[model samples]
Target: IRYSVVAGGFHEGEISCMDICIQRPIIATLSKEDSSIRVWNYDSGECELVKSYHSLQKEFQNTNQTYLQSVALHPSGFYMAVSFIDRVKVYHLMQNEIREYRSLDIKNCHSLKFSTGGQYLACID
Candidate 1:
């Protein structure tokens, strides 16, 4: 097998965690250094979405400090889960945008993964 670079120079900081969707050419990535989540279309070499934890905290009126941990894309490419130091949040992906779907109060979650069938989300604290 061979490998090549598809996209570059998009992330300003080191990517701490990432996951790819099984049903689509979508990749979900988290950069702890920037406290942001980015969704990329690997095939088109395009960044579909970028979300900052600071913005989310402001939107939700959360004032506590926290850091990003991990990101996971659903097998169907319809959902993304992001784990943070204080909690885990699930987002719905649509039209290159992410909407808040649900929040899991799993504190200090360091890892996240969706089941192969996309029926369950597993996390490690």
Candidate 2:
């Protein structure tokens, strides 16, 4: 019932493509104008930007008009998940880098959710 929301810069004329971790303190998103995914820090009102959500894109998925379709957080909060048009990627919060441990390709992954227990990830392709 209590929270702090911080706003960040975005791609020109680009809408926010993201999903919230309900009841959690993190958010994930992408912007075509910026060509990146941004993971926001939402605790203690630190007002910090954990940029480098996703820095690289494959040739076919790279475009100036990309939009993140979905996002989720591992139950443990040690990791975060982001979904794109052609892939799904996870990140390690502490390392501030991609996990490089897993990725899913099914195209147009519009939504994703992590089981409360963190047992499995449900991604809608």
lDDT of each: 0.84, 0.62
Model 1 bad stretches (over 4 Å): 1-9, 55-66
Write model 2 residue lDDT over 18-100, tens digit each, in one string. 65565557666666545565656566433233444344534435455354566677866676777777688776766445455
TM-score of each: 0.83, 0.61
Worst 10 residues of 2 by lDDT: 45-54
Q: Write the per-residue lDDT of candidate 1 for residues 1-125, one digit (tens) a residue.
A: 99977775466788889899989998988887677888998889878888887665454345454477889999999899988777899999989579999998899888999999999999987
TM-score of structure candidate 1: 0.83
Candidate 1 at residue 73, lDDT?
92
